[model samples]
Target: MNAESSVGAQPTASAPKRFALPSPARRALLRAGLTGAAAVGVSTALGAASASATPTTTSRNRPGTPDEALRELAVGNRRWRTFRQRHPHESPAVRQSLTSGQEPFAVVLGCIDSRVPPELVFDQGLGDLMTVRSAGEVLDEAVLGSVAYGVLELDIPLVMVLGHQSCGAVKAAVAADESGESLPAHIQYIADRIAPNIDRTKEGDARVDATIDANVRAVRAALAAEPDLAAKIATGELAVVGARYELSDQRVHRLA
Candidate 1:
């Protein structure tokens, strides 16, 4: 009743009647703020994603050129020769990294001898090489296919035919050739493949070594003439090289 009596008088200011936006206007304002914040968040996330992706690409695609691949092998072999092998690319992180894909740089054709594993001789680690082995580095259709796959599909730039000192395969061939004794079973296949190369060498203490080198060169030449590999070599996109692993010094010497 006391308030109604003040109808003629101005009502108490009531804190100056605070102004308020309508409900729809407030909702619109809230939506605009959220949209701007979401856009900022998306931009930041994309920038971070791009920053993270680049290094992984570079790391996965390293040793891009043939010369670089050869140099890496040379440096790794030096470490092995000095007994300072870093034994790189074998950690858990490296294993996980390679789970995505492999980018081997070279294809190594070595002997089946346990003493001359190409990875150890080159001081390389997992995913560093595509290794194909046979008795005396012999090249048959299967071997050629493997080598060609590496060159043509994987884009491997180097193929090394690696022979070693005192190869038993070469010695068997030499013995069979000298004594006219036939090697039995599939062992004969190895001996036959190696026989012609040994026949080109002089009969002496160095005959086995000569034959080993000759076999390496022969395989290298064979690989070079492979139609698929030859095209790559002709374009200077690949190199076929012969090298020898010396058992005495644990050293690799490139053959001429």
Candidate 2:
């Protein structure tokens, strides 16, 4: 799915009309200029990768099984890494067909990082994935409710907690505990929740990637431990998987 499409299109300032230029030529040139301007704007606003030739990622219908969900994502990543993305499948028919119902395949709990979009990383099309995001992929009441909706209402069988390298949220939590600095009231709650997992983490760790991985595992265990979801696991109606993303390689390694 094109998450960006959630914003839909907005009319920008109209380009100065080309008085002497012919209508067709002027329109083509104007569109080209806007595309270039957009490229620059996105790169500056988001990051360098936004300017690259890599086709932006999107998802279609949700996959059926957990393994199938995983495979679909893997294929998407392959296309992304190799710059061979398939054209999007959205059309009037697909939109109209989904208007009455939506059956997403997988539910993902992930960080609110723009770079690690679940649909893009997994290369899923529209309606293919149900995603919940927060800083550090932290679990809170609201986040839990979102996950529950995906599982109970959407009937998504696989829920993946996707963490990633160089996570700013996890780093802040680690630093807060190490320095004994009191975090903000709400942030303090998050730090407290994640602090134990940090303690269980190895000593003398230099890389934040390790903490990111550990946090994914910790969140998965915590989710499973919740009485609300534990019952579903017992009946084999749901599976919770953990994964970490590699920033350099653009890959997701499953932890659970």
TM-score winner among the candidates? 1
Q: What would the per-residue lDDT of candidate 1 be over residues 1-256, giving only the tens digit for each residue?
A: 0111211111121111112222445545554554456556757876321111112332745576656766777788888888998877899887666544567888999999999987887788877888999988877767776676566656788888889998999998888888898998998898887776774547664787788877777677666655566667776777777788889988887776
State each candidate's clash count: 0, 10
Where is model 2 poorest over a 10-residue stretch in terms of lDDT?
1-10
The 10 consecutive residues of candidate 1 with the worst lDDT sum are 1-10
TM-score of candidate 1 against the unseen true structure: 0.75
Residues 34-94 of candidate 2 have per-residue lDDT tens digits of 4567668867887632222121233344465655666666677777666677634466765
Each prediction's Cα RMSD? 31.3, 17.2
For model 2, what is the error of residue 114's alpha carbon versus the real structure, in angstroms, after optimal superposition?
1.7
**Displacement of the residue 8 alpha carbon in candidate 1, Å:** 99
Q: Please, what is the TM-score per model?
A: 0.75, 0.70
RMSD after Cα superposition, model 2: 17.2
